[model samples]
Target: MSALIDRFNRRIEYVRLSVTDRCDLRCTYCMPKGFKDFSEPDEWMSFDEIERVIAAFGRLGVHRLRITGGEPLVRKDLPKLVNRLYHLPGIEDLSLSTNATRLSKNADSLYQAGISRINVSLDSLKPDRFKSLTGGKLEKVLEGLMAAKNAGFSPIKINMVVMRGVNDDEVESMVEFCIKHHFTLRFIETMPMGETGQSASSQYLNLQTVKKQLARRYELIPGMMPGGGPARYVRVAGTDLRIGFITPISQHFCETCNRVRLSVEGTLYLCLGQEDKMELRSLLRNGITDYELERTLRQAIDLKPERHEFNEEPSKVVRFMSKTGG
Candidate 1:
């Protein structure tokens, strides 16, 4: 089968699957109040259900997959799920995105289970500031980072959500750490999301400003990050470190968007900054065949928007970034 191209002619080759929407942190940008209306135990798609959907995607030439969550590792025995997805025929790349709190304990097992790459979200390098920002101990995430490196995951990425005054002060510190450790660091602009809706509007920091600050100290050579996401990667001259800017707010990447999201409750979303979505869990539970599933997905992808009007309408999304599996 050929790849599915959207109305804009962008081929959809990746999918983000949110295994769970529950997190152990109270990151103000993602979940101000910690938890959400969690999907009931029965509401979450089963491993079998997820596999079928992934297989359907594979037939459509969508071979890359990334698992996400409020915290994906927080879900019980996540390596088992990883192992399952690893064996699927069409999955060329498999990864997980998390806060890395659980990575300390599960990194080794997760690596052995076929997850070779990971994206760990770390906002601040200062312990106190990090605690205040995410409501989690910074030491735990650091420990997880070490464990991940030792586990042999290549291109372990640090996703730092840069804000105006929140963690912007530590941008240099974050870059130094990544430079020292040979890790890829991506600075993401805050988007207006979550129930409180305070992070994006109040805390949004332009990446262009951050880039200027970086250019003063180190030479940032232009490049792209491997295992492609939205980030525009740049090489830090004379170092193994690479800096990435995911400017969803300041600069939208929707025109080149090549991914879709499947929430824990089985909903399929075409755009990250939009509220519209298609119900897939129900259709799966209703026993649709693989062929029918592929047809439905093609129809949805055909309607995928060329861009997300986040700046035009900041309140476009009220759901937390956690629920959306960003």
Candidate 2:
């Protein structure tokens, strides 16, 4: 089968599927301090429906899948869904982007269910600072990370959203932690994907400046990860750890964007920064034929934005990142 190609000729091989939008923690930047904006239970796509959609995507040459959410682990019986997706015919890689709040309880089960890669979002190592940043105990995440390590997940990556003043001091300390544990560290530039609901916008901290210092401190050799996203990588000289930067604000990597996102509501977000989405829930439940499903997906690909516009004081063209499974 021919690959799902977007308007710009980028092969769409990866999909970030959000199982549920309900999260256990309220991160300061990610969600409002007292936010509880979760869709109704029935509104969520069922496991069967999710599998069928994934199967359709697999038929269209989508090979990599990342289970994401407000917090994927918060969804009950997630391993069941993970097990199903892992056995999909054309799926080459299965992973999850999580906060690790519940990884300790489920990491072994997730690994047994065929998920071998994981990305944990941890902004600060200081317990007090972490509590202030994410409104959750850092100790739980630490325990979960240890569980992931014990479960034998390879190449665990820690994602740190760098803000100019908040937790930015932890950059070196976070790097030190990753180096000590032999984990990949990725510093992401906080994006204005949407307004305060999506996330509280702050002064973005470009990783290039940090990269310069790190380069001066150690040899920075360019490298790549196994799958998905456009974050560039640099090896840490003589160690197995690699430092990564997901700079949506400082550097645009959309030209090479090769993935689409599926929101919990079954909307296909062609670009992370755009609101253009195609509703697929009705089609899936209406018993749409495989041919029709493929047609709808291809049409959605045609609508994928060339790039995101995030330069203004507040980018007015995007949805809440939580709604889109960021």
Best by the lDDT measure: 1
The global C-alpha lDDT for each of the candidates, from Candidate 1 onward, is 0.87, 0.86
lDDT of 1 by residue, 205-270 (tens): 899999999999999899877775888888989988889899987778887889999998888888
All models, RMSD in angstroms: 1.2, 1.4
lDDT by residue (1-326, candidate 2, tens digit) is: 67899879899999999998888877766666687767987889999888988998999999999999989998889999999999999998999999999999999999999998999999999999889888899999999999999999987999998887887777888878999998899999877765653355655777898788777778889887776867899888788888889987778898999989998889899987777789999988888998898888989999998987675435665456677887
Q: Which stretches of candidate 2 lie over 4 Å from their true place?
A: 197-199
TM-scores for every predicted model: 0.97, 0.96
Return the TM-score for candidate 1, rounded to 2 decimals.
Answer: 0.97
What pairs collide in candidate 2? Answer: none
> Alpha-carbon error at 272 in model 2, in Å?
0.7
